[model samples]
Target: MTGPSAVPPVTVLPVGGHGLLVELPTAEAAEALHAELLRRRRTGTLPPVREIVPGARTVLLEGLAEPRRLAEELPHWRVPPLSRTGGTAVRIPVRYDGPDLAEVAALWGLSEQEVGAVHASAEYRVAFCGFAPGFGYLTVLGAGYEVPRRASPRTRVPAGAVGLAGAYTGIYPRSSPGGWQLIGTAVDTVLWDPERTPAALLEPGTRVRFEPVDSAGTPIGDSADPDIPDPDIPDTPSGSREPR
Candidate 1:
């Protein structure tokens, strides 16, 4: 069946012994299928599987007892476009002073301040989580905010660094090498905590917004204090690469 874009049909391929990789034409379509799978599984209509991992344009289902049977059935299941507004809302305070902020502004054809304004105005969703434990690949609801990755990969990117690459915006969970364009730094946010229930602050399907703030934890361009709550939990050290 055709996906949300309706340009191409869904393709399911066998992965390893018990996994099936379902590919779609677009990230939005993948999200739709992922949501549908979750709904069916919750309602006891889907087959048993160990994991359903969503990616930019694909969903990887692992631990299937009958991969070939499910693969044949996946192409016939109709899934609607995911609702952009559905998900848990999270606001992250960012200090727009990254090393690559000026570069990103020039690419966007806007001033440094305007860049922050534009980036902060968009509502983003966690399309998937990969590369690192707490790193989430966040995508905007609409189009036209794409950015190219850095020409040269950095030897080390500090934890809390907010970056943009292609259609995704991600934060570095810990210090590691990366190529994403750094646009800002998340303030008073713990990206990963082993002690936390979910460990990662940003999970797949979570809605996110960036709130521009200055030093001392006050909202920029306004007198009101956002009173952004501190994560307060100790971070777990990780050597994983930054999320793409």
Candidate 2:
């Protein structure tokens, strides 16, 4: 609120036996701080840290050798504003046809085609990954695009079902019960491949753009923008990403 509070007062608390929870006021502040901690860990300046897990408004520091020392030093850690360059981007092809497509269009006072255009045109980022493995909580590029979940939860949402919830969009990695507003479905992409190098295609801080596809699974839009492929995704199958 009020244009991101002054340096979101961080509250460090014991998370578990070997972890500490560094809380922030907003998701933006938390993500920025998580990036900073991750960068430090990559450079070997971090104190014996094993993992830096980012949440909506907190960063969980796990496998720390000295949790108390890190907790004491966390307040001094400076967090920068999130930049578009803060993370890697992955292109995902989607077909704009879900059970909730018409409902979502009506919610935003737009036609199904208009909704598809608006949705595909915006850039998104992985705010965090949870609820399900390989499922990412993606922040919408433009505001006023939030959609509420369904009145009744679906007992089995198929894998690759693209959905929107609150201020974020998500994809179902496997058949499971869910209540998010379904808007589309990604084409032929493996949301999770245990055999792949990076089992999860999406990761926290990763940028994502949903490219629209047609009934034949052909990419409707011309091409991908800012076509810098993420190397970490590994040899993905067809329909996930293609040559620009």
Reference-based lDDT, each prediction: 0.81, 0.79
User: 9-83, model 1: which lDDT tens digit per residue?
Assistant: 789988998999999876767877888999999999988999999999999999998888889888888675566
- All candidates' TM-scores? 0.84, 0.84
In angstroms, the error of model 2 at 154 is 0.5
Residue 234 in model 1: lDDT: 22
RMSD of each candidate? Answer: 9.4, 8.0
In the predicted model 1, the residue pairs found to clash are none
lDDT of 2 by residue, 1-244 (tens): 3333444578999978789998987676787788888788889878987778888889988898778888888898765556665445788889999999999889887789767777777667788889989999987534456787888999999999999888888999998999998889999888788999899999888888788999898888554333432212222222223343
Worst 10 residues of 2 by lDDT: 229-238
Best by lDDT: 1
Poorly placed runs, candidate 1 (over 4 Å): 1-8, 141-144, 222-244
